[model samples]
Target chain A: MSPQSSVLYDAPGPRTRRRTTIAAVLIGVALLAGAYYLVYRPLEAKGQFTAVKWGPLVDLADPNLPLVWERIRLGIIATLTAAALAIVCSLLAGTLLAVVRMLLKEQAKRRYAGLPAAAAYALRGLNTALRGITRFCVEVFRGLPVLVTIFFAWRISGISDPLWPLVIGLSIYNSVVIAEIIRSGMEGLPRGQREAADSLGLTPFQAILLVQLPQAFRIMLPALISQLVVILKDTTLGYIITYEDILAVAQQMIQILQNPIQMYVIIGAVFIAINYALSQLAAYVQRRVSRVRAHKPAAAATELAASEPVVLDA
Target chain B: MDVLIDNADVFVSGFWLTLQLCVLSATGALLIGTIVAAMRISPVPSLRWAGATYVTLVRNLPLTIVFFLTSFGLPELGSNADFLRVPGLSSVFDRLGIDLPYFRFAVIALSVYTAAFVCEAIRSGVNAVPAGQAEAARSLGLTFRQNLLSIVLPQAWRAAIVPLGSVIIAMIKNSALAGAFGVTGELFSSGQNLTSSGGNPIIPVFIGISIGYLIMTVPLGIFIDRVENRRAVAR
Candidate 1:
């Protein structure tokens, strides 16, 4: 009904308006009937809608409610702990890998001045080899499914603690993804960012560390937050390795309560709530970043400083 | 190495199932996604809200939970609503010799989950079409559907191809979850079975499995990059 959406068609006349109302009513009724038949009736017939089935999770008067909450609280703490560890590890490793790969690429392209010809050739070979190795690792990690990576970590790495394997696996895969995100962010910057750094007499490494990376990170903050949500979601995979995360704990509760549907619904709701909040934050940050870039370009440095800690808190 | 060479058929069949899951799920996602996209942009406010609600709910829920709901929860609902039991459709699948209900459930889960991403990709594509293009089409006395099909969607599809490819590639990776949830013979479960039952070395079995996924994903990655680069050049 907005003017913007109306761009696709003309404003409705009286006859068109009547037709639209009739169509909308019919569609809405059909949708309601479909939902009733597909979801409500089936669930009702199965006794899933009974208060007894939902009492453990929702009813305060239930005797087992406190114990259930305790388990869920601990499960949430465990999931967050793993997610935090993975987020920290991946951010650091991803930044390092991105910088090192960038440096190695520059090294491969640069001529070694005032060096022996043989030494220069050998250095070039080393640069190329390092770059190749870096590329290989990134590709391999990015290509493999995170579950397989987690499985490998759990099985082959001799890590007895379930949390470490989950953390290590998530960190590896997510670090590679973050590195690519950072690399693309840097690439998206105007050429002047690099040229200005060079004109200021900074070495390639120093320029990248001091100048290019900060801007890239700032530009890619929304992506980084979204990836954090991914890490949080993936921590649930620890259930496979028996890691006592929220989902795993939910399964344990189901054994005693015999309410798999209620438990999973609660668990799913928790995840959806958390992830939806994170994604909304990402969208908010994206909007703010673009606004900051658009207006008052001169104050961007201070604005960037102000915004940094808010994202890091996640 | 010898382990992989001896179990070549296992790996082959595993990857084949993975490929089939991807193809079927991708098709379903595309069909459902297109309809959702249409609904999201339709003139009806209720339809728009419905589309938005669907995308938000599905996108936020983890795929594992979606799989759990479809595979375990559907059966518990006691509905005789087997989607494959439609009059003529069951016969087509019967002819193809693929009749695992769990496999069908996995496909349902995957298609439903991945369709959210596909819907977002298409909406982005629609946004990429200029306002003037739609206005021009409307001024020429074209209906909304005609304007969308002739003017908007063609350009949108072109703009959407790179993102759609990435979505498909992600779906391929996600199909790994199907193996764990009970759809056997996929790459992940095959690796799991080989290591656990066959007593093969975990490293080699996993390595073989990773190779199968890379075979599916890496080439697609390259193709996406090439298409993206070509688009950039065209622009």
Candidate 2:
């Protein structure tokens, strides 16, 4: 670090400087030695650091390599398809959940407003029941690991598509998370938005659907994209169930090719690339949203009718 | 339900193992994460670059890849099993009653992957510590380490409570993946075993397993909320 210290603190005194220099050198040496021990030396001992292990990967010129690429292409397709299905399903499920949770609270409020003798009692019962069910679904799905959720879906899933289990599992767990994101986004809006809707003669439900939700969903787009990346990553879990996705394909090929390290590296890099592209797409969309909102603030509500994805805080 | 009762031992142990994995991994993650967070906020440029690179690389990668590296990849190269036998570590493992090689790999994978998230949380927490606090510490003639350890980290952790809680809950859910890699006596594997064993009625087994997880995860979440609320009120 430069001795040109910024506002956080002044440059270290002579003793402090010597101590920091010694500490930095020690940490640097430790880092280098740790890397060598953990990565370089062990792999070298196993002959994994040699060209023999990596040469096949470098020979992209071979004509027969297209067959291997074909399997990888298919695996990538399967992984993406599963992620797409899960993302769609989760968004639908999450919006429904957020709305349901909201209505449950709203129903409780109305229950005490003296609607009627029989109807109030029925509504009370219904509200209590709905509240229990919603809370259970949200908490259980949220609390359960995604893999276990997938395991359950795999066991029960009777669909023809082999990926149904993964899709269902991802949707259930992520929707709970997504619902929280969307609800929090709405909750974050200024109370003035709702008061304006009320003054404009919109009912609470209409205000939620038209005014609050649209705004929240817009603000939530970036977070939603990040969650989609998570879903994409979890698609690798499909390997456990013997799903022939990209990761599974790599695992299978690694056995035949005897290049586990190289295969997994390639697979990991593929995932990183795809996810990085998705993140960039999210950033681009965020910029576009801001641009549109800035250009014509009045038309944003109408023009943004489509449910752009909602973002989570994470 | 009958399946659940018949395999109560499996479910109970699975819950225990999952809980053990979460606790150990969360502790390891917190330690590693704090160091990385310190590196991130340090005055050293190289340290900051190293920290940033780690967060970027690991955060973008799938946890499954991490699990693969530790479980399958490491074993392929050589054995780190001897490290587990170190007196201090082994006795801790003995107390936890988890001896499987897979459990060790799971702990390594889960903690390493989780540390990236935890580092981000803590770095943000560090950033949230008002600049004035550091200035005040400097004015008090405290050393840089003193400023960080005494003045900064305590408040950083407070700022980090919610995100760190989410990371812990996420870690709990994530520990279930250890089962896929042949970590016996964990929730996911136990559920998987029920199916392969035949005539076990798999749906209820998994529902039971999810409930086992909820037993661990929900309480942690509620506890974090209580802590956050308490911290807020104190401030």
Candidate 3:
């Protein structure tokens, strides 16, 4: 079999493929050597850096090693905590609002079914306001960059803590996104599903919690995971305000070390690895969730998909 | 406040330069990004791999690095230190028939970074189009370019609006980073100028920087949103 067919074929028949592979390997090796020369050698020549002391990554004894560890530790703590809080809070708030809107829609549909015309107009206005407010909040948050928002929080808010600023900024911005996701998910639900729940005498709250939310979360998991990745990246923005996140720490080291290229290359590799792992986790969860309801209808699947954030924040 | 008002011309001129930079870089980036995107989704694996790697490296790395690379490293590469200090590298390159140095580097970096994002946006947009659309166009005897330009692209562009909008906004924000190295008339320029002149609070300087971005982007954001809402209604 040709190399492309088996997905693991050893037959390297194409001259171009073989050349390209070799070239890529060489370039990678060259990049690694260049990095070693730029970063590792500079400190090594100074005698300020000891390889043995830096060997234990978690140890705080060595100045260089501690600084690196602290930066990574701070970055992880800030990002993971903020993302967890934002996801949980946003999911709850979004789901609640979605349910409320859904209930309102159903009530409006029922009341307008045989209503007096003037009364129906007032009801429509109210519904419009709810939708408008939801959209407006989402837009305001989405429109502003997360860095600016975080900066504002740090500048004006009572909380002077770096981590709080990141959490608050990311949470508020992501909450807006999460709400839109949930609203869309709710919209994707079939009228019949709600109608069936209603006909069976289930309260609106019960119908949403029992019949809708579980399925919506399943669809939303991948999008949520993607959002988590964005949240992870935004944590680096803390560096701008002297917030001591990983990127900030790296930038500081670059200034002190005077080796921009090597520092950035290292940080980029780390970021890519972290994000790749997160995405893989997301995919795995998505598959596991989907397997639980392999036979679900298109409407349910659509609703589930809607509940997840579609746009990956860069 | 009065001092700032008195030097309003400086601010205005700065604003103008910043606005120009934002628009110029955005346009340049979009064009570069589109080409990169095409290369990325090309049938040839080498082009596709190159495009993918470019986007991955650019997107994963911070914009500050790119800014520093052009601002600091490029000067060292060229023999003409005197030429590098000139407002535009065009003079150094003008000897070689090139012009527009300050704008060129800013635009190049902005385009390179933004192109990475644009590539992703375009790739996603292209992917969103069902395979059948291109297949149908192909089956009908339209050339590949003709099919892309006439049919595939128009549809992809529309679908790509959300991500594209975000990318453009990001470019506007990134244009400020250019001030860190060169381009004194940009948003970051005002901060650099202010710091050098009287040493106002950096927070306020950054705030001003952000406000400048808001003025450039918020309107564009509203427009994209209206388009999205219209699409939603149509659906």
Candidate 4:
């Protein structure tokens, strides 16, 4: 038994140990039988295990192997290209939107004692209108499915190239999501950071831009990387729009080789490998960030006490 | 406006299908996710390994690839060749007067994909329960299963509700992919059909489809916020 199991149960006695051993063996046998009956037999029956199906992907000696790898390489490039563009766009736009919303809220609260009453009222009205419109856009884009947004971008923009629409659509949806992440990250910071910025005579916009935003980005690095993984995964949706990303390229190969199962399995494994690596990076960053905070115990304690709980936005 | 009015039936039925997809997939995900969570927390090393492997593999793979695998791979395996011929399973579906191979495939894909996230959410919830709770239960001579069912899970579920709501909401959006991958009459494909063949203007058709999704998602988003706020207050 694992150490973690001790939380729920004590070390087993002889009889309990034997019982657990028997249970484990039973589960092992069941798992093996299930795998054989549900997976191997059916796949074998369809001759999916045959060398012809696997050769292009796995057999170094196969004549088609080089071409297959080349296509896969190109496909990966296309996928990364789209994902990178979308990630950059989303991050910049999302931060801008977050900052704008924050500033608008600040403006709404300010008494504007130095300004005339009519001018102050006009400024407040503008702030409210901008806030309302911004909120509506964020909510709409966030609520709509990324695919639907891509379709709308594709149709409305009359973009013939699938990559632009895919990028635009991903940007629109992910920007709002990232905005929420940034907002939460900012909220998670100690209130004193904002106060310090204010004491230094920085305006609300400058304080956010110089102090809060950078710290939020640092604190939220792990989450941002995870979101990158999400964007990378979503780039596959370009297949629906006929974008020649890796998945679409795999489909074309399947059409040629008549090996849908093998092709898809390969594609799925590729995705898993890339995304797993990205997630591991996110985890590493999270560990490093926390460790840095741990070194500053006094500051960390105060930060923790003052910070609001940061719930991940979906 | 005219396009939306003229095609009201399409939008309604499309969203109805989307709702069905979400409901079925959510139920399947919860069931499988709970089992996987149990496996992960079990004392047996092999079960823990199996559960970890399942979650890792599924979580890393894209939902689109999962959909493609089910749409193409299941037929090759002969599992979904004819849903009506699957013996005991067929009878249940037959009695319900429904047999949709593509829809079933899509549900399988969504459930399998979403179950990974659900497992993580549930495990986090379990982790949120203080160690003292479990230790106390063990000291009281409650067995692992009894302790989990009575003490751990009851509290874990309360913490899990917010994350689960988010997962379900994401599932509703992810279900849009099913419409593209041969599950017709869902919001996406209906919009596609209207714009391409029904001679409706593209903007209105998409706007109508957007509303269909928002109607499902927005309220759920609000409810989750409310629940989260209440939990914060309680804490």
Candidate 5:
């Protein structure tokens, strides 16, 4: 409202103000009624609100009561396990892909200077073919839903554990998105940094490693974390292929308890809790990075950040 | 290849249904998303809170989980089926021979999922509107709604087309999840049927589907980019 305060309409006059208040009140009431009818009434009618169905929740301390706590506990571990593996793999894969993409760009700008004609010709052919392959892989993975990739990977991976399929699927898909984030992050940096490193006799690889990657990683931290949260949420897709994740446990409970409402609500809450924490960590990192960057008058908040690369998850 | 040819009908129907779910839900998500976006920018605090809460709640949960809630939970409410049995409504579905229950919940799930993303994109668009434009609208004595409708949103939508198109592609991908939940005739379910038909067709079948999706999505991205570049040039 501060920047957005339009001078177009004056502050509503008393009558108009009253009308706005009334309309707001009506909307609030309608929302409440809509929620009650759409959600509450249906739940209540099915006896889902009753203590007997929800009673198992409170019996955690009672040793006599059998519970799926162990499964749920294992499910949490499994989800984290998949997320951790996928995060590492995607980061490595993304970095490699980003480097290759940068190579493609550099090759396009190649000058044939200081090279043998045959060597130059070979490099050009290799560059085009490499570009073509990487571009297709990235586009295919990015275009297809992660769910389909997971399904395909699960079937064709021919691995014993379902875990490998989910992790690989999540990695290949997310690596493309993360690569974009990395590439954009590097592009946003002042060319001066790399040029200065080169003037100091740093090799291109040394300049990139010592000077550029750190800056790009810092700039891309917020985006990287969001993609990680995407990876986290995507582990739920593991459940569809019957991977032992939190969602699968939640689904299993419904068959036993006949409480899809309560079960799904519980599952949804767990996901919200985990994802909220991850995003909060991301928010904290962004704030810290921005604060430090602000101290140095860095133009780190580039327009590239605004072009959010869509996260593809399995 | 022969496996693909043999199951050609299944793939066709699946692609058709995937397209249907994608289009319908994208439309629904856009409408509801616009309203939610409006609520966020409204002068009223309560409406803003409601809009913010909806986005947070929906965006935080995965679409698969949302589908689980819709397909499993909504049916427990019983009204979903009862509504289909309503006097005049049941007849329309009957004439069309659509299984109202599964289709309704799938659409609901997809809309409920995609709408949060659509809201974010449109809200970003709203934010992108120059302050001067809003000021100009206000100076001309335009009401809040009038300024939004006539001045801000028109510009916003143009800025929004690319992001919104990305959301549509994501929704198309997500429709495969509905097939997971027993919604018949989408690529995921068709792939499942093909798999059970035996011999690692899961590879060829889903690879074909991935190719199908790429064909659908890549063109969308290109078209949007073309328009976006043209718009930029015009500006």
Candidate 6:
């Protein structure tokens, strides 16, 4: 359509382009292989490779495996606690923020049209500053590695064991993401719905809570579910803080028992099960929500129709 | 302050090693992931199953566990340690004069773990591409690969970049876990050297390591977000 488009279409003959692309890919693969050989072959030659030892892994059944079970239990406890905290805190914080902003928007619309120009400018400035602060906070939290944040929290005065720091860090970081999802969901609501609610004499709080929040939640459920999954997986970062998450337990098992690889495989299976289960649950909830929402009007109308006979008989 | 300044040289070397491992492994995983993504979308049922299984396995598993599999488990299998038996392979490898066992293990682990998410991201990216684009390419007599490379991938890559970038950032962060492997080649000798020293300030040491990770992860995150924003604007 444009000169650039034509140039792109004409730049290389198709045959030449195909050959170059394939060649580039092949060369890249070969370079990776060569690099691997250069770095890994020598390490493999070391005694790092030993015959399969099942004894240490099997010894897990023995009651004397004190730290092993403690590590595993503590890790699971920490991960679950962190996940629950993040979800609850983020949902509450994000919803409150979204409601406050939406309320401010309605007030602005009502107050601004008749305002003097100077007052309008002041109002606009205040709005801009609020949005700016929200963005800055989100960027700062999201920009930092969750692990760094957790480490910072652990080092900062009050918190003791690594679990609290991890949970607090997760909550702060994930709240930003949750807030964004909420803001976007609020924006997605049709203007007509807002006008309809206003015309019905509904208060701003009533309209948002009764008319809007339900719909927004439905729209955002998928994102929220995926965020939960992310947070769940992110719990693995606890291993760094010595919080005894699944990975930490695996690390302890590997180090104390000296069967590093086998234990790792077992740990991997544990994480897979946890995450896969979460994903499946998310899919189930999504389907359930959609189906219920789809039938809402029909179900409501059917109930109304069924009640009409009783009203007439009475 | 004096100790930190004294250790600046080790810190810089560690930074370089971190970059090397992250970039190399990210690239390797991206390649494997792209292939798996293709397989996930392939017509063959077996390929699709393989892709699905791989994505499920890697996406769910803790990356450290995968790293362990590479660093320690492979040797137990016996096959992983065997010398190159390819025609003229051993001689060529020798001529290059490279020793790469640790590199290979790291690459394998990082790539396999990364590929799972890559598959998910790329699959979603492909899903985002309108069916019309593929139809247009096919109408032009482009074969499957050509259609994929020309029409689907570029568009899908745009959609895929955010999640893929997140996964890459995850890999970089997870690269710090390499310290736990007792591998000397890793970037942060944090877990080992700190624990071994026993008296060193653990907080500063960890904070320093965190800063190092921030240096690696933060910029990529900004870039990816920027790219995603641009794509949003374009669409």
| Model number with the top TM-score | 4
Provide DockQ values for all models, in the order shown: 0.50, 0.49, 0.17, 0.62, 0.56, 0.16
Instruction: Give lDDT tens digits, candidate 5, residues A141-231.
Output: 8888888888778888778689999999889888888997888788778888879998999866777778877888887887788788888
lDDT of 2 by residue, B112-219 (tens): 899988987876667667778878888999877788778877987887887788888888888888887777768788788888775588778877887898898899
lDDT digits (tens) for residues B106-219 of candidate 6: 656777887777777777677667777777777787776787788988988877778788878777766665555543535565423643464566556655665676787788
Question: Model 4, residue A288: what's the lDDT?
Answer: 73
Clashing pairs for predicted structure model 4, backbone only: none
**Poorest 10 consecutive residues by lDDT, candidate 1 chain B:** B90-99
Rank list by DockQ: 4, 5, 1, 2, 3, 6
Q: Please give each candidate's TM-score.
A: 0.93, 0.88, 0.70, 0.94, 0.90, 0.69
Global Cα RMSD, each model: 3.8, 4.7, 7.1, 2.8, 3.3, 11.5
Residue pairs with backbone atoms closer than 3 Å in model 1 (clashes) = none
Candidate 3 C-alpha error for residue B165, in Å:
3.1
Residue lDDT tens for model 1, A127-155: 98899999999988888888889888898
Query: How far off is residue A312 in model 5, in Å?
Result: 10
- Give the poorly placed runs of model 2, Cα more than 4 Å off: A1-8, A11-30, A111-115, A279-314, B88-92, B95-100, B231-235
When 1 and 2 are scored with lDDT, the better candidate is: 1
Runs in model 3 with CA error above 4 Å?
A: A1-134, A283-294, A299-312, B1-18, B62-106, B140-151, B173-219, B225-235
Query: Residue B106: error of model 5 in Å?
Result: 1.1
* Total clashing pairs for each candidate: 0, 5, 2, 0, 2, 10
lDDT of 2 by residue, A1-314 (tens): 31212435667689867877787777778888988988888788888867655655656865546777788889999989998999999999999888778767766877456576888888799899989999888878888889888877877875545698888988999999989778866776666788999899997788888988888788777777888888988878887777778888888877887877877777778887887788778778776766766676454442332223223122
Better of 3 and 5 by lDDT: 5
Model 6, A180-283: lDDT tens digits are: 67766666666666789889999988999887787677666766776787777777777766776777667666666676665666666777888788778766
- Candidate 5 error regions (>4 Å): A1-19, A58-66, A287-314, B81-97, B200-202, B228-235
lDDT of 4 by residue, A144-255 (tens): 9999998888878888999999999999999999998887778777888899999999999999999888888877888888889888988889888888999889988989
The DockQ-derived docking category for candidate 1 is medium
How big a share of the true inter-chain contacts is recovered in candidate 3? Answer: 0.08
How is the predicted docking of candidate 2 categorized under the CAPRI scheme?
medium
DockQ of 1: 0.50
Tell me the lDDT of model 2 at B11: 87
Which model is ahead, 4 or 6, in terms of TM-score?
A: 4
Which 10-residue window in model 6 chain B sums to the lowest lDDT? B89-98
Error of 6 at B46 (Å): 2.7
